[model samples]
Target: EETHPVIIAGFGHFGNTVGRFLRANGVNATYLDIDSDRVALLRRMGFKVYYGDASRHDLLRAAGAAHAKLLVIAIDNVEKRLEMIETAKKHFPNLHLYVRSRNRFDAYELLNAGMLHVYRESLDTSLRMGVDVLKMLGHDAYHATRMSKMFLKYDEKNLKKLAAIEDREAYILEARTRMEELERILQEDTNNRLMLQVDAAWDDASLIKEATQQATAQTE
Candidate 1:
C-alpha cells in the first residue's frame, strides 16, 4: 500500500475545502469517498480521489491509514461517521483523528468516545455572523469581534464540561448555570471602562489569546 501523511474520508464541501487547503500548502493526502459520482467529478477536476466506503477496515488500510499521521473524518452521515471513528480507533490506534461534528451534541458523543479533535461545522461561521450583526447594530467593530472571541472561547470550554456529565437532569442544571454565568461575565466586561480604551485594529490572534487568558483567569 502507498503511504501518505494524511487521509481524508469524505470529499464533500467541508472535506473539499480541507483537501484543497492541504494540497495548496504542499501537503500530500489520500482522499476517499463513497460516492462514485462525486469521486468522478473530483477526478475530472484533477483530484486523485478513491471511491470506497471509508468505514470499512480494508479500505482504510488500503488508503494508507497505517502510516498516515492524521485522519480527517468529514463524512456527512452521523451513523457512518461514528462507525468510521470506531473502525479507526480499533485498527489504526496510531492515527490521530480529526472529526467534523454537526453540532454540540455530536461533539459530545465524539468526546465521550475519546476523539480529541472535534470541529463543530457551524460554530465559527455562526460566531462570525453574530459579529457582523453586532457591527450593523452600531457596536464598535473591535468590541464586537472581541466579544465573539470570548463567546467562542467560553462555549468551547463549556462544551467539554457539559459533555462529561452523564446525567440528563444534572447536565441541564449545569448548562443553565453556565449560561447565566456567561451573561454576568459579559455584562461586567461591557461595564468596564478600561476594556473599552483600546483603539487597535482587529487582530484575530491577539483576540483569541486574550480570550483564552481571560477564561483561564476566571476559572482560577
Candidate 2:
C-alpha cells in the first residue's frame, strides 16, 4: 500500500473535511480521534484511522507519527488540542504541526508550546463575511482590507505611545487631533462631499466599468 502522509488528530468536523479533501486527490491520510463513532465512520468510509488519544506517545508512533509529513490538530476541546500539540512538539519535532484554536487563550497556549502556525479558524471566515458586507455597500475589497490592516497597526502604535502618558484625557485629546491631522494629510484635495462620492465609486465593478467605457469612447 502506498503510505499516506498526513496524520490529522481529532477527526471532528474540521479535521474530517481536511482528510476528505486530501483523499479526493488520491492522497491517503491517517486520522486520530477520541470519538469512537467518528473513527468508525472514517474506517467504514475506507480511511485509515486510529481510534486513539493523540497525546500518548505510543499511539502517535504506532500511527507512523514520526514519518508523517504533516500533523493537523483540529480538536474542538482546547485542553485536548494543547495536549496533542505538546506531544507532537516534544516527540515528533520533525513533523510540521498545524493547530486550530477556539479562542485567544487556546492560541496563547499553543504559541507557548512553540507552535507558531496556529489558526483561530472562525476568525478569518467572520472577517471575510464582514468584508463582503462592506463590499456590497460599495467598499473596494483591496481598500477595505488595507484600511482594516492599517487601522489595526495604527491603533496598536498609538496604544504603545500612550502607554506612558500620565493623563488619560490629555492622551485621548492629543490622539484625536493627531488622527485628524493624518486624515487631512492622506485625503484627496477636495471638499469632504466630493471625496465621499469618489470613495463610493472606487470599488472594482465601478472602476472597471468606468475604465472600459472611457477607453471605448476614446477609441471611437
Candidate 3:
C-alpha cells in the first residue's frame, strides 16, 4: 500500500515552506491545495500536489488523511481553516493536527478548539527582525537573541493565559502587568550576563568550514 504519513492541506507560502523543509529532511508528504492554478504550476515544477478543498471529508480521505499520521493545516482562509479542523476531527480522529494561525486572535480560536500545535505566521519572523534591530543598535548578538527567545516563551504562555479571561478590561490590565513583568525579567537576565560564550563553537570560521564540508560532500 502506498502511504504518505504526513498530509499537508494547502500549498501557499507557509504550506510550501513546511513541505520543502520536510522533503529536505528526506520525509515525503502528500499535498492537497484548493487552487487548481497552483496545483498545475507546482506539478509542472516537479511537485506532486493534488487539487481539492481540504475541508471536504471525501477529498481528505482520497488524499490519505485517514491513514496519515500528521495533518498540517496551513490554509490562509479563517473559515476554511476551521472547517478543515472540524472535518479532520470527524473523519480522522487519530490524526495529529498542526495548524498555522494568522495572528494572536486566530491562535486563541485554535487553542480554544483544542489544537496544541499552532504557529503564528508572522510572530517568529517579526521577533527575529526585532533581534536584528537590537543588534544593529549596538547590543550583543547573543544577548539580543536570548532576549527574543525569552519574549517568545513569555508571550506564548501569556496568550494561553489570556485566552480564558472573559472580561476585556481585566485582560488588558493583566496583559499590561505581564508586559512589565517580561521587561523586568529581561533586564535581570541581561544584568546577570546570562549569555552563551562567544567561543570557537560560535566562531564564523568554524561555521564556514562546516558549511563548506557539507557542500563538498553533496557535490561528491
Tell me the TM-score of each prediction against the true structure: 0.85, 0.63, 0.86
* lDDT per residue as tens, model 1, 1-220: 6688999999999999999999999998999999999999999999989999999999999998988899999999999999999999999998999999999999999999998899999999999999999999998899788888888889888899999999999999999999888877777887774444542333665888899999999999
lDDT of 3 by residue, 47-66 (tens): 88999889999988898887
Better of 1 and 3 by TM-score: 3
Order of quality (lDDT): 1, 3, 2
Pairs that clash in candidate 3? none
What are the clashing pairs of model 1? none
Which parts of model 1 have CA positions greater than 4 angstroms off?
Answer: 193-220
Per-residue lDDT tens digits of candidate 2, residues 1-220?
3345888888877898888998888878778889898788878988777887888989888888878888888878777777777788789887898888775445555665677567766665665677788799997688667555554445434434444455769867877876775456334322554677778878766889999999999999
Clashing pairs in 2: none
Segments of candidate 3 deviating more than 4 angstroms: 194-220
- Best model number under lDDT: 1
lDDT: worst 10-residue window of model 3: 192-201
Query: Which structure is stronger by lDDT: 1 or 3?
Result: 1
